[model samples]
Target chain A: MDAFQAIADPSRREILRLLSRDTMTINALADNFDMSRPAVSKHIKALDSAGLISIQNIGKERYCILNQEGFDELQEWIDYFDTFWKSKLKKLEMLLNEKAGK
Target chain B: MNRDIVHRWQFRQSPEIVWEHLTKPELLSQWLMANDIKPEVGHKFRFTTNPLLKFGFDGIVYCEVLEVDPPKRLSYSWKGGPGNGKIALDSLVTWTLTLKDGGTELLLEHTGFSGMKNYFGYLMMKNGWGSKIRKRLGALLAGPGK
Candidate 1:
């Protein structure tokens, strides 16, 4: 599943929000939801497949935390034009500087 | 994600100089893509860049001026995708220029990234902007990425 599909579900997005604050065990994450444990597991698998969250095993528990790989591109895309204008304006500054010198 | 992009820059030039760079088609093509932009409300323009046939992008951004306040603000509609006449992403790009302490400050806001299918194009747009800003403008300034 892609990052877009991973975020399509509200439950998955909630999981991401919770994990962003702090790492949560699979059971802890599942407890926060109103669905079955298997259903929650299904969502986690989808998130895992999308590389949005990472599951780590410590002793008997699997902890899920937010992954940087998730939505990095999305965030970049959202901020793309902002950067574009900055660069464009910077070039404008150079042209203005040349005009001032002459 | 909010999907809204806002950025601001300060240049040591008057609003008129910066405004010319924004509204003049020739100056815009030097910095942005090739376009026949005019400084008037309701003017239609198109920006052409390197074609991305594989990603369904014809590298053409069709635009129409929505607002024009000379030496102050300019807004336009941006739509780009495959040349099939189908709009891949429909968004608005606004530019605001303000005179400051013998200089000008420019603010840009691009919004309206709706739905999931457009996300891919959005990602490509991000890379395209990043590269252009970092590469082309950086080359002109000689030290932007630093």
Candidate 2:
């Protein structure tokens, strides 16, 4: 699942917002949702599997925080395209310059 | 939005000349990649490069020109993957050129993701993160932990 898939739902987006400022325990995150806890958990699981968030256990609590993994997927795409196009365009610029010089 | 890449660049040249670099195969290969690209709409072409086997890509970005409006607008279908009919991404690449500042303003839009599924799969495979994704998927299927 990509970052887009992870945040594809309103609930998931809300969950991300809830965790955006700081890490929140699973229970704490669930209290904000109107849906059943299991449904909320399902969303959490989806987000987790999609690498949007990380679930870490501190003692008996499962804390959730925004993870860089999925965002990195997005960033990777942007970076690759940025580099790909810039390099090609640079070459084109040089080629055009050469033509102008000639 | 949603994985679409939009880029803009300025070229100190006429749209006619910039358009040539975009359409002519020899000129395109000098800047982009080796290909048999043409300005004709519906013309099929492929940009070939070194194979990236790790990503299951044969290094051939198959494309088909979709629209061409000489020196103004152009669009094409960009498809690639592990060959043999399997594709990781089925995207559209569109280019628009505007005459401004006595130069050409080139805009590129690569869209058609998020509406599809295989792109994430392709990226995951390309990044060699399949094992980690599988682990996460397993955890998801096992239901949430208490």
Candidate 3:
């Protein structure tokens, strides 16, 4: 999934907002949400997969922090235009339809 | 580290028909922006769009024809923004068309986003890049153990 899809969820966005403030263990991060630990873990996994967060095993516990490098790769203007093109191309499709009708 | 954005679409039109939309300046503007586009290599062109000066978008894009394979491929440099001895946005847009069963398959690859500076310049185009991603970047700047 793209970074947008990863953060599309409100809960995941909240998790990112929390991580933006400071690094926290998975358990601590889970406590902020009113959901199952496993659900929170799933969200973290999604963020980690999308390069939105970094998970480090600090001895017995795993810590999660916002991945700075991941954000760098995603902030490209093209990322926004990726969506823009989708819409623009749809308009192109419509124009093609009009031309075909004529 | 390549941040190219690729968008693919399958249209119900022949590659030859789609080629016109990609090559003809008037047809191209219907979907993209107004331009003096020509289908010859090394040809220079300027794409003009609605002005959004507040975001640093002077409604102009400087371009040059890079590659042209009529009905199959087209590539060009895409650059714009305040030019004051510093290049704000510089990239390439390549369009590839493939003949399909009943229509054409189009692929757009826009590449060359290298560093943090370019990233911001891109956001400042029309969308509030600062409001959208700055929180995350700001956090990265103030990251723990940094």
Candidate 4:
């Protein structure tokens, strides 16, 4: 699942909301949600796959922390063109300026 | 994320000169990439560039002129990708030249960045996600991640 699909769910977005503030274990995270532990786990797993969170094993407990990887793909697409269009236009401007100068 | 890219520039040159630079393949290669672009509508062409492996694009943009109005407006279908000629980005590129008081006004709009399958769900994620999510994560990310 991509970031958008992962975030489409309110529960998963809540999970992201919680993780962004503090790193928490599955049990602690499940306690905040009214859903079944396994269901929350499924959501957590989806967030992990979407690169929204990173899971780490601290002893027997697994901790989930918010990550930026999820936003990279979406942000990068726009940023690429942002730079590309600006630079390409700059080049075009220079071409016109040079021709007029001559 | 970005729905479209729009750029407008003022040039002392005339619209006719700007139109030539836009439609002529040889002049186009100077500003854009090397391509066999013709002003005629329905003409097919492609721009050759280095492969952008990170973005899943081979860097060559295949195009077809959808509309043409000399010295006024032009549009084309832009499609490209790699692997058996798969199309990753299928978009519309448009250019408009309007005569201004002193010279020509060039406008470019490159749209349709949301159609990619993996990014399709994001159409709602833009407005639906809203400022709530950003407000929640902004402080956290700004604190340590910056």
Q: What are the runs in model 4 whose C-alpha is more than 4 Å off?
A: A1-53, A63-72, B117-146
Tell me the TM-score that candidate 1 gets on chain A alone.
Answer: 0.71
CAPRI docking class of candidate 4: acceptable
**TM-score of chain B for predicted candidate 2:** 0.77
By TM-score, the best candidate is 4
Arrange candidates, best lDDT first: 4, 3, 2, 1
Top-lDDT candidate index: 4
Comparing candidate 2 with candidate 3, which one achieves the higher TM-score? 2
Off by over 4 Å in 3: A1-76, B52-55, B115-146
lDDT score at residue A45, model 3, on the 0-100 scale: 94
Candidate 2 local lDDT, B1-146, one digit each (tens)? 23567778888999999999999999899889999998898899999998765334578988999999999999999887667766655678899999999999999887663212454344445444434444543322221131
Best by DockQ: 4
Number of backbone collisions per candidate, in order? 0, 0, 0, 0
Ranking by TM-score: 4, 2, 3, 1
lDDT, candidate 2, at A13: 75
Q: State which candidate, 3 or 4, has the greater TM-score.
A: 4
Clashes of 2: 0
Whole-model lDDT for model 4 versus the true structure? 0.77
Expressed as tens digits, the lDDT of each residue in B96-123 for candidate 1 is 9999998988888887653233543343
Question: Which residue pairs show collisions in model 1?
Answer: none
> Any runs in candidate 2 off by more than 4 Å, and if so which?
A1-75, B114-146
Residues forming the 10-long window of minimal summed lDDT in candidate 2 chain A: A70-79
Scored by CA lDDT, what does every candidate get? Answer: 0.73, 0.74, 0.75, 0.77
TM-score of chain B of each: 0.76, 0.77, 0.73, 0.78
